[model samples]
Target: MLKKSELKDLVLEYGKKFLFPDFTNKLTWFVAGVGGAIILTPTPLKLIIYNWLVDSANLNSGTRFTLAELAPDAADYSVGVVLIIGALLHNIANRYLVYKEKKASSHDVSGQTNQIDKELFKKFLEDFPSNSDSIDMLRQQDFSNSFNIFRLANLEKFVEEWDTVEREFLNTDLERMRRELWEACYTFNYKLSMGAYDLNGGPIFSCIPDAYRGTDNWPAHVDEKIDELNGLSTTCFKLYEEFVRFGRKSIA
Candidate 1:
């Protein structure tokens, strides 16, 4: 009963709530806090060095000594202190960045997982045979009459062809035709899910393969046709599983 725009809005809202700005903000704060802590510790040491130079060494004036008179010991001590501070800063920054990245990655993964779960639930509802009554009601609506009549007519024709195949070639072509029918159904359902057509009328027939009209070698080629259709059906089902399950699990 949900409108296409409503469904889209829901998806966007969930994505924003469970997936975006907050995760990025937390990561930024973590990095800033670690960097600040590491950098602030070096300030006291710098002050201590300045005090020793001015009071203990009595070297208040700028022109009091040359570079050689400064002594390598003090220079070495200063260099060592700077290196230690830089090293700590680098470590903190690296760790913070890595942790943030991992957290963001996990959030993305969980988002994808939830999306797949939602999509599968939708497909289950669509594929359920009992839901056909609801679809029928939708088709009967005044809004549906404007654009969906053609698709409905085509679906009727397709069902008739399906019935004919079931009756005449039940033994030979039934399995193949069944597979094709399922594929057509799946394609139609996917197009609906993507909102590729108007709510009232969609390009369902355009998404389907042409009806089987071959008459030559009807008996001999029946098995081959069935094999081909089954192959296609299997592939489509596999695609569903991959996108709906395996791929999502990988991200999670």
Candidate 2:
């Protein structure tokens, strides 16, 4: 004997697959068109008309159905088909109404689990240090040394921190934040690594002829780099702010 909960789950699962809204909507049309056509098919001539359609469509060329095979009489087959069609229509319409009503009432009936999830998500954001020390590990690097080496080390540390935090929160939104934060970190690191920057009162690397001397627009290029760095900084901080906002938002 199955439990009530298990039976309910099974039925819900079956409904989700077999009677999906779109599928049921299409099924309604299919049954209406095909069943109505068959019912209106003007009898004694009913099987002949159907078999003619089949033959015209080249459906199973060697075979045809008989009235006896379908039902004892033409009227009996029509009646039986009409009853089956009516029952199916009723079942589908009822299920569709139930589905819609449940959807409309979902937020009202969100219950304890939704509240618990909101709390858990908020708490997870509070505990996550992406906005704090983890991000700082990348930002506070000394570029005078092997900059890529520092970036790789800091990036690894940030990833380690992310890995630790990821185990705590299973939310898709949180996972998206992690991905965005990682992208921001990598973008900043790549920008800093590739470009020669004036740091510590000197150029970190000799400016390339292509970057400086090859074009008279080098000053504009330098301005573009500055703008890009500012944008990257803004993006990184925006993610941090988003995290803070999500944490602070009303759980109710």
Candidate 3:
């Protein structure tokens, strides 16, 4: 099994190389060539070309192949697969760059980018707790906190809570702090979720009503999402403290 950081590195490396890669790049050519080959093979159109070759050679007509050599379904399926994969790759690269740019451009009170904030970035890299033990120390927990732990039903309410944080809590006029907090939330959000899509609150689910539309079990897994959001919220606060507690103060 691949280590998490190694896997992340692989994804970023390949995502950057193959998604809208320069024409001269080998990985770009490889993706195009492989995708083309996949679509062209197991297709009748290829058989027609082969037949032309056979006839041109005129060696013999003893080939046992029939006219239906190409499988139409296979061609259509390959096209769809290639298109979906290509679209996802392009999207992944775009999102990665957006997050990188957001974090990189953020500055300290001394006007240094967040990237050079070694201790803060180190904290950013640290793994958060799996259980709520740390959270328990920070605040009081009750039935309501665990009530949605694994939502058996009532997806609407679960998503409503999520949207409240994303829209109301995150939307702010404090330009620097707001942007930094958002980037922190999004970074944690992306790391926790396994899927390729951003899934980072506002970017993934604009509102409560729309959260469950594309998913199969927002109602069932609502609790896990709640857990994620809570964890991200905690991390966002820590990131803010890193700015305030340290001598950084605020953006220059």
Candidate 3: stretches off by over 4 Å:
1-43, 48-68, 71-75, 108-252
lDDT of 2 by residue, 1-252 (tens): 999999999999778656544434666566556766666666656767655766666655667544333332646346547755775766667778778879878755565545665766655555544555535634553322222233244444544555454343344565566567767866865685566544344423323333353445557666576567556656765776675565445344
lDDT of 1 by residue, 1-252 (tens): 999999999998776544333423554445555545444545555555555666645555545542233332332344445555554565566567667879999988768656654554343334432235323523343221223434344333333443443222212232343445545545544433342234324443121212322333334344453444344434544443333343234323
Give the TM-score comparing model 3 with the true structure, all chains together. Answer: 0.22
| Pairs with steric clashes in candidate 1 | none
What lDDT tens digits, residue by residue, belong to model 3 across residues 1-252?
A: 999999999998887655555545566556666666656566666666667876765556565543345555544456546754885576567667867767766533224433334443333223222133332322332211322222211222222233333322111233345356546645544543432222343232221224554555556455555565556556665655553444234321
TM-score-best of 1 and 2: 2
Q: Show how many residue pairs clash in every candidate, following the order shown.
A: 0, 0, 2
Give lDDT for model 1: 0.44
Ranking by TM-score: 2, 1, 3
**What C-alpha lDDT, on a 0 to 100 scale, does residue 144 get in candidate 2?**
25
| lDDT of residue 20 for candidate 2 | 46
Q: Model 1, 67: alpha-carbon shift in Å?
A: 16
